[model samples]
Target: MSPSVLLRWALRDSARGVTASWIGGLGYQAGLILLPWCLGRALDEGITPGDRSPLLSWAAATLAVSVALTGAEFAMRWWATLAGVRTGNRLLLRLSERVLGWDAVTAHRFSAGDLVTRGTRDVEQITIWISTVPSLASGVLGLFTVLVVVATLDPMLAVVGLGTVPLLIAVNLWYPRRYEAANAALSAAHGARADAVEDLLSASTAVRGLGGEQVLVERHHEASATVHDRTLALARIAAGWAANAPFVPWLATAAGLAFGGLAVLDGRFSVGGLVSFASWMTLLGRQVMMLTFRFGQLGDAWTAAGRIEAVLSAESEMSDKATSLLPAGALATDGVSVELPDREPLRLPDLSVGPGEFVAVVGPVGTGKTTLLRLLARLADPSTGAIRYGGTDLRDAAIADVRDTITIVGQRPLLLSGTIAENLRLGRTELTDGQLREACRIAGILEHIESLPEGFATEVGERGSTVSGGQLQRLALARGLLRGARVLLLDDVTSAVDARTEQRILDGLRELDVTIVFATSRTAVRDRADRVVDLGVHDGELVSHG
Candidate 1:
């Protein structure tokens, strides 16, 4: 989207706040304008003439304006702040929901670390800008209004008052681009550093086991240094702007006021008028500074919003199929083919399994068995042929419906961070206690969990981190069973468990037919297959035929 669209979209959501903030801002600036006016009026009418009536009127007006400004400032602060936070938080939730909607392939295209930054840091940066934006905009307009009034009252004093304004406006216009560039680089550095640190912590066991602690540390240090350098560069840029900002304004203001002072002494200007002009300059100068700062933050926020938009707007490899399929129990692939990023093509000549029929598929590693199963699951599209359900093309069916119909039991199942029971159920709430126990039994994890102090209700820690590899795998298996899919694709499910447990799991699954396509490299499972899909170099040509 264009920059104008971005600005309007960001602020328009908080329309009520924008209105409330400005109305209250008008009140605040009215008081600021009246403060000098009341002082000048008192000097001209009461203090100069020694009349108590003018003094009393000026004092009352001052008190009223003071009270109004205070109340208005408070209202604006609270109203704008709440609105910004609410809008930012709602947008963040929407962004996260969109992220979750992303398909596996789309998600893999971006780093998890970058996503974290966009969601948290980037969203917050924009929120802060929004909180201050309306008031800042209003304040700038107020300054301009005050300058016009001063010019009408007395042009010479007004010119002296506005001596610093043009220079300040120029600085404001020029500062944002450089500031945004520096901050964007800093954000990228921060993302890389976060990635490095997360990797080090996540793979601590591997690093220590491989005696590569020093290597990981060096890598982390390097990433940290890069981030540090970028951060320092941002600091330097901000500092340069801050220091150079006051130079032109002060020089112009000093020279104008010095010359204006002689006119005042020659009865060309009143004392109260001169004071009012100085007051206008101070007020306008502050507003100019606020506008500069506000716009700079808006620029940084815009940069962040653009990155977030890129991720949110990304398209999936498999486009959406809006046609919903009635739930059915069938799966098949005919002449399925797949091509890797840089590798030769692999083919699946034919495959069929009736509903509720458990079948084993045995092959050496890299036999394209897993790839074939994933295509059946619609995780990736087949290159040239179709996978079907009950003679209907899978690609033509509703994607959400298809996914709901099948679940894959992968080699390494990453469970969400939660309680054991929570991870097992995922989001489905239809499973009963008895059914859950049966699934755990089938997955060879029931007895193991019964021994724990909390049993099924135990917290599994982040990503099931508190559990061993075998245990986590069993938890994943239980999750799949709880899903009650019409088709179950077991891809090396036995890779992590002991032979006895594996045998128990296989024996339990044999009772039901769910169009199972079990992919394995295990010698023990070879004899269990009704058909073998060989994918190896046969003769001169590479071959794959079931």
Candidate 2:
């Protein structure tokens, strides 16, 4: 959806709070506008004419207006704050839901850090804009009220007030476009910097091992410098508009003072009338400054909304039709090929695997073993053809059903930051400790895990950084085994383990009733398979032997 449409929907969602805030703001402005009139009444009747009765009455009126102003101000701020927070939280949840559902291809469209900034800082800008809306509306309304009040006192003073509008308009006419462009540039710079920082954190170990810390540090520094420059640019534009816009109102105020002072001296304007107009001129100056700042905030939010819109607009290439149900039978591929970006299409030869069979796919590097397994597991869809499970086209079946039936474990296993057992069980909190240990034992990682200080409760750190590569692979494999899937697609999961552990894992697999499709270059794995599908590069094409 476009940013405007998104904002409209958000406003509707928070309509009650926003409306209450606006009402409070209007009340506050009314109280402020009335205070000057009350002061004028006190000066004219009590001070000038020396009437105790009028003085006492106007004083009470002034006190009442002050009390109402305090209450209205509190209500205005309270409602604006609550409304902004509610809208921000709703937007954050929506963005998170969309991000979590992304496929690998869709996820790669943005860096992790960029997505993080979009969900956080970008949403915050929109929230700030929401909170500013009531204040801006009230300020404008109050300024108009001041002009109307002054026109009644004297036409000359009203002319002075009206004169500022053109000046304020001239001051602001060039600011919106400039501020918006600067804000957008700054947002992009922030996203880039966030991406650079994430890269530094995630790849610091590998970069230091290669003695390339300087390279990463230099890249981060460059990104930081760009962010700094863009921020300064946006700030300068905003400051210029703020500094200049309010000054026009001040000039108008000075002109009103000079004109009203002459009128008072000539007995054409009363002393009380001059007092009220001068007070209004001062208030109007502040309102002009406040409105300019709010407009700048609006520009900031507009740019942020566009950035957020970009993420929400992405479309997943995979189809998710559930018209056909997956059935129990052999798994097969027909004219399957995947067209990768800037590379030759990866072609998989037609093949069939019977139920409960052990099939090993042997191939060298870049032979498309991983790609083939990904398609089989429905992690991705084939670009050119179909893969069938029980004669049902994989695309035609529900994605959830396919994933529940087949689980694929990659070479580099991902373990979230948690205890070893927690990572193994994932969300299946119902699984007992015995069940977890059984899966780990089958994967040949239980011995190592038990040797740790915390045993099964050992923390793996982020992405299993605290564990060895072999241990990570084992943990992931164990987790997959616990699922009890009908078919298991493993992409060289044992690549990090020793030969002995590899053999143990293979032996453990023999005890399971599930169909196994293993992709690897290891002879130890191919020798033990019931059948081997050998993939080799021929001339300019990839071919497979069944």
Candidate 3:
């Protein structure tokens, strides 16, 4: 989606609120225009002639307009804010939905921090801009109202009031181009700084272990400096424009007052007409300032919209046409291959595993063990050739169906910050505590959880930081087991555990009525497998041994 399309989507989604806001804004502007006219009428018909009746009537009219304007202003702002927030949240939801559907190949296009910034800060920018739209529109119409009112009183006064307007508008127009460039630079700096901060937080432990905390801190500081510099650049441009844009309208106001005073003295204009002309000139100046500021906001929003477009427009490489349910049977790979970044392609020799068999894929580090598991789990597709489950091509089955029958536990599993029970349940609220405990027992994590002070209610901290690496791995395994998938793919899940615990997990897994595909280099795991496929045993090819 382009920036224009994104803007149209926002407007279309919140049309009712935006329409109501526009109506309220027009009401407010009409009241504002009437106030000065009412005061002028009182001055001419009553105050000048020393009659109190006309003056009193106009005073009540002015107060009534003021009250109505107050209510209209409230409605305008309330509806505008509601519309903006609603549109922003809708855009955020769409972005999240797209991101969740991304395959591994599509996921690598942006950093986690970049995506976060686009979803949050960029959305906020667009929301603020949307909120300003009603005011900008009403203010422009108000300026014209002032012009028409002045022209009715005296065309010469209208000329005086608008003498500098064209020039002021040209200057205002020039500011957006410059402001947009500065805003875009600032946005990019913000994304980079966010990425640096994310890295510092996620890898703080590793940097401390390497005794390179200072190095990481310096890197973050550099990123911060760039953001600061870009921010200052944008602020300077905005400040200069704000200070200058409204000043020209003031010059027009001074000219209008001078000419109007002469006309009033010469009896060509009434005292009341001069007062109304001066009031209209003041309104024009204020409107110029407001509209210019809104235009600047538009520049910032355009930059944000472009960034949002980048995220929404990214297409996934994986196909999603398959709707067939995956059948249960043997799993096999036919000349499956995957191209690796900065490495040789992984080529798997033809292999087959019968139903309910335990198979192990063994290889040295970086030998594509995890890649093969990912392919089998359908987390990604093979670059060439195909894998089949029960004689049906993996790509020909619906992804949801594939995932329903297979569960994969990665080497570094992600555990959200929550209670132990919540992590295990993962929205499957129907699963009882007994089922959770039984799954944990099979994964060799039940004893550990029961020994905790809070038991299943214990908080796991962010990414399971409170737990040891081995314990985190076990918890993830337990969670995967609770899925009750027919096939389980393990990617060195037992690497962090002790030998005894690893053996215990393996023994428990053997008793389950599920197909097991384990990827590991440990001798114990391969020895227990019905068959072992070792990628390291052959150059660019997998070799199976029984």
**Clash numbers, per candidate:** 3, 0, 0
Per-model lDDT: 0.75, 0.86, 0.86
Taking the tens digit of each residue's C-alpha lDDT, what string does model 2 give over 304-353?
Answer: 88888888878767778866545567888888988988998988877787
Off by over 4 Å in 3: 46-51, 209-211, 539-546
In model 3, how large is the Cα lDDT of residue 342? 91
User: What TM-score, computed on C-alpha atoms, does each candidate reach?
Assistant: 0.88, 0.89, 0.93
Q: Considering lDDT, which of the candidate structures 1 and 2 is the better prediction for this target?
A: 2
Across residues 1-546, which tens digit of lDDT does each residue of candidate 3 receive? 669889888888888888889889999999889988987887888574656787788888889999999999999999999999999899999999889778987989998888988999999988998888898889889988887787788777777665666878788877888899999999988888888888889888887878777777888999899999999999999998887887886887787778888888889998888887778777777877788889888888899999999988888887765666455688888889998779788887677777788989887887788988999988899989898888888888877788888899999998898999999999899999999999899889999999999999999999998999999999999999999898999988999999999999999899998899999978889888888887876643443556
Ranking by lDDT: 3, 2, 1
Top model number, TM-score:
3
lDDT score, candidate 1: 0.75
For residue 353, model 1's alpha carbon misses the true position, in angstroms, by 1.9
How well does candidate 2 score on lDDT at residue 500? 99
Better of 2 and 3 by TM-score: 3
Ten-residue region with minimum lDDT total, candidate 3? 537-546
TM-score of 3: 0.93
User: Which run of 10 residues does model 2 get worst, by summed lDDT?
Assistant: 537-546
